[model samples]
Target: MDAAPIIVHRPRGTGGRRVTVRGQIIGLAHSDRDLIEFLRQSGLDETTAEEMVGSNSAMIEWRGGRPHDYAAA
Candidate 1:
């Protein structure tokens, strides 16, 4: 069976930044290495980037344009 798509909405006005690969967002994040590199470039330094991206499930929610909640999926 195919998997349902998981929606991770990017809040509006995020400096118009979006992750796209081969002209699409889907399948862009195809591996942990890519995610870690993205997090680092997104400003999370090496340690934090590694930790966050290494996890299986990481959910970050924001309120007032800042990270207000985080939890595992």
Candidate 2:
């Protein structure tokens, strides 16, 4: 089976943030609303967005950092 698309949050320089799905850069998201909008713009439904945001399957990365899997949290 294909792996589920991973939602990633990364810290951008100048204190901004960006979101990506399946390695494709979506858009900047500094808050939940912005993240939702980015996900929607990336063609994800509301349900999928919620799942991705709340799921332990998501990933997060900081500037000059390695990916941190939420599943470990």
Candidate 3:
């Protein structure tokens, strides 16, 4: 992933002016998901993968999707 980070925003505007915007960065729990997978393929088990991956909540909240949905898919 790009270490520089990302931005999300909502903008409101009229012919006269603009207003009401919000933004946030989407980031990994640690180095990135690829790094986690690398460790796992190298023999790290699921338990350690969970630890290294940190949190999935970031994606869940950003996507407004439940954590279980990814697994089901």
What RMSD does each model have against the real structure? Answer: 13.6, 6.2, 13.7
Arrange candidates by TM-score, highest first: which order? 2, 1, 3
lDDT of each: 0.39, 0.55, 0.32
Write one digit per residue (lDDT tens) for candidate 2, span 1-73: 6544644545555544656567787776566566666776778797776666655443433333333221211
lDDT of 1 by residue, 1-73 (tens): 4321222223344221233322334322323555556556656698885765455333322223323112221
TM-score of each: 0.39, 0.54, 0.27
Q: In candidate 2, what residue range of length 10 has the lowest lDDT sum?
A: 64-73
For candidate 3, lDDT tens digit of each residue in 6-55?
A: 11112213111111112332222222354345445546686775564466
Better of 1 and 2 by TM-score: 2
The model with the greatest TM-score is: 2
What pairs collide in candidate 2?
A: none
In model 2, the runs with Cα more than 4 Å from the true position are: 1-9, 58-73
In the predicted model 1, the residue pairs found to clash are none
Model 2 CA RMSD to the hidden true structure, in angstroms: 6.2
